[model samples]
Target: MAGMKKLLIALMMAVAAPTHAEVFAKGADIGWLPQMEATGYKFYDSDGKEEDCFRILKDHGINTIRLRTWVHPSNDRASGHNSKDETVAMALRAQRWGMRVMIDFHYSDSWADPQQQRKPAAWEGHDFPQLLDDVYNYTHEVMQALKQAGVTPEWVQVGNETRTGMIYPEGHTDNWPQLAQLINRGYDAIKAVSPSSKVVLHLDRGNDNAWFRTWFDNAQKYGAKYDVIGMSYYPFWLDGRPDYSESISDLGANLNDMAARYDKEVMVVEVGGVDTEPQNTYDMLLAVQRKVADVPGGKGLGVIYWEPQGARSWSHYELSAWGADGRPTKAMEAFRVKLGDK
Candidate 1:
């Protein structure tokens, strides 16, 4: 254990103080991938039964687990989404196994992303200030619930895929002030209950530097405070995965620039491309990680491969199902390489 800690510390130091040439090297050691705990479609599973999956992941190197929370889904069920109880159960299970927890707040009943930012059922008629208070109350209650369950989160995301602002219209103040207030409300709520938890402001466009500038600039304009700037990097969906070299340079520059610009840590909170695709996408993902590990800001924390085990066997709550055999998927190999475990 002492040796492992020493190695971890040494790798971090190397990443923090790499030379200019090292920053651009094709085989750089940006940092090791922090082993994470991930649960995708299983999060929405009824009865909240996923002990086997959690155990399997724990046996691996994953030390943290992330679950998403929506408001009120059109479906009147509490599987792995929208319902606070379900999320709490999942967190508790992970906690029981001594795994860290990260809760992703989507701020909508369904999927909240750059495309749409829907309002919650109760806040449909509320005004801007009222909506702000709603956000504060919702965040407080949820975090409080987790605490009562003895599952304090290691990380909390204010909004999910929020390429656009969250709690729409009023809180979505692209003008800065309103947006800052809304963002801070959530941040403050998390801090109030779980002061140790790291709060994140998430966006969808990971590769686009302009989007990062605009969103973070607006958040700052609105006095938005957060510990990390999170992004979703799905090359299959977004700019079509570039070659490993191109991905490394572009993504590394983006991470370095964003960290410097915001003076805050950054993370690829959600990232994955197709593994069973035209084949190129899967290859692209591996190359992307290699490039990131070699880039300057590639050490911007770690990357979370969104739903690699969620093979499409499950629907409605269909997350990605990258798992090929009963074992892990090819994407797992990419993460292994990221950690130098390969």
Candidate 2:
């Protein structure tokens, strides 16, 4: 009778426990960290104290680091900073700081974005079948390197901002079959290398729910097996400059819709400031936080600031909060301090 009573009591306690607690993503894309350090760029905290960038962000409650990788980048590219070895080194740093890592693979020698999904030069002559092989091999190699370096990424984006598709005209939206095959190949490689890593299908125009529905529906219909929906939200560039106040509501609704419709995780994988309006950025990000938090079952993963280390611009990203002094501007308060805090 005593053992039975104890067992029943323990079972009752377990049933009363919460199924899962929310895990909010407070993160930054410090992809430019290595290139900036090489060019004598330094980072300082608000107190004007010299500090490593990773330590500074972590102190501000950031829990994840996003890095980009490229295939045989050239000197003319955005400092050619996102090579496999470079990414491994950077991810290792994030791991040491106890931050989760998310690797964004552009898959091209240079930028692979919505507007231009240029294929890597090395893959120009290969057929579709061969290109698929290359993608699997490259992804596997990168994951292997990161694993060897003692850093396994929590998430891996097969292609960055791939609304129209990746690897150029060969795998563009116009060619859905080829694109789906390529995406799945990358997915298979991630599974083979690190089975725990979640795959993301990142695209631009995050606030526009209609676009997402169409894009994701098409992706699924064509066999794009993604574990997460990653979105890039830039106020200035999206919709020819959006009105932050009015659009934030739509952003929330869209986030909720995505979470419910996909039955998968959603994340604002990329967002940034347009002007130096720190308060506006703060307000916008706060809205994002609320929307993501409200997702049923906490499927809304988190937001990642695209190159938030705005102090140095090896890539010359205009949307940054870091000023000329290598210290973050008031704009960074969006991530550093809570909405109601000082």
Best by lDDT: 2
**lDDT tens digits by residue: candidate 1, 27-124:** 11100111112223332222333445555454434456677787765543223344677678877877787666778887778777877888887789
lDDT of 2 by residue, 212-314 (tens): 8988888879988989999888877866586666677777788888878878888888888853676777777777766676778878888888887755344
Q: What are the models' TM-scores?
A: 0.76, 0.90
Model 1: lDDT of residue 273: 54
What is the C-alpha local distance difference test score of candidate 2?
Answer: 0.82
What is the TM-score of candidate 1? 0.76
lDDT of candidates 1 onward, in order: 0.64, 0.82
